[model samples]
Target: MQDEKLNPSDETPKPEAGGAEPEFDYIDAEELDRLKAERDEFRDKFMRALADAENSRKRSERDRREAEQYGGSRLARDLLPVHDNLRRALEAISDEQRAQSAALIEGVELTLRELHNVFGKHGITLISPQPGDQFDPQIHQAMFEAPVPGTVAGTVLQCMADGFMLHDRLLRPAQVGVSSNVG
Candidate 1:
């Protein structure tokens, strides 16, 4: 119930009863500089580590976005043959034959058009080159080269199979025949 005074021996060191201030722990200039240098080095290291972590996070985000954008490339490529076969089936039917089976032809043509629309929505584009168009190696794969009269060298003689692009990337190259100049 009563307050007790603490003994001097129990107290931490302080200035004596003399008017002179106790010599505070005198740190030398060299020690102060060393401590400052150590602090600066640790601060620099911490900043570098922080920057590295930020950069890693940004890279991961970019990679995730790219994966989302291009994740269907493999499946799209695999389904290309189906598209080609469908086109060929329509092409194989003569006009008279198509007229004879008007409903069947209409259904197939509608389905093909729907498929193309789906591809367009997903950023799939064709690279079909007509005859005599200039050949571009970037989007065309030359299946054969032949000498043709009055045709420019490196001109696309024919496109056997059309190419496709998924966004800016090439999904497939157009199968083509190139022409060479002949006398």
Candidate 2:
């Protein structure tokens, strides 16, 4: 190529030729501030949404655990009648009759014991109320009230139907007779 020379008047533009440096066209201060604000707002909203989703998940897990823990409550309540019947049958046999046929009585006793074992295995428990014990409305249903001379009022005079519990919850309240100080 031939040697070429440029005039000073046609020289390339210098960095500071103008009084001010060339402004960057890529982003203006107003646009940058608006974009940053938008980004910050979106970030805050996303974090909040994520936290809400986590809370919802935790709530669902708690509900599921509660359901699993108490799922058999209804079935356990229904099984209470079977336990009652078994107890009643054992109670029906007199001591004299039991002594007369020890083998037969033993067989009945064994069967009753097995039934109770099954109940315990499934978290079923008997609520045997004692005479003179304070009656509790939560676990005792008063069938009748009678005056029993020296007994305190609201004392359990008799348990007509035994109560039962499945876990800590009452499956059935005891049908009971209370004693009062009046005629």
Q: Which candidate's TM-score is highest?
A: 1
Output the TM-score of candidate 2: 0.71
TM agreement with the true structure for every prediction:
0.83, 0.71
RMSD of each: 7.0, 8.1
The digit string of per-residue lDDT tens for model 1 on 1-183 reads: 789899988987666799566776989999999999999999999999999999999999999988987999999999899889888999899989987999998998998899899899888998999999989989999999999898989999988899999999999999999998753
Give the Å shift of residue 44 in candidate 2.
Answer: 4.0
> lDDT (0-100) at residue 22 of candidate 2?
67
Q: Report the error of model 1 at residue 1, Å.
A: 28
lDDT for model 1: 0.92
Candidate that scores best on lDDT: 1
The C-alpha local distance difference test score for the whole of candidate 2 amounts to 0.85
Pairs of residues at least 3 apart in sequence or in different chains that clash in candidate 2: none
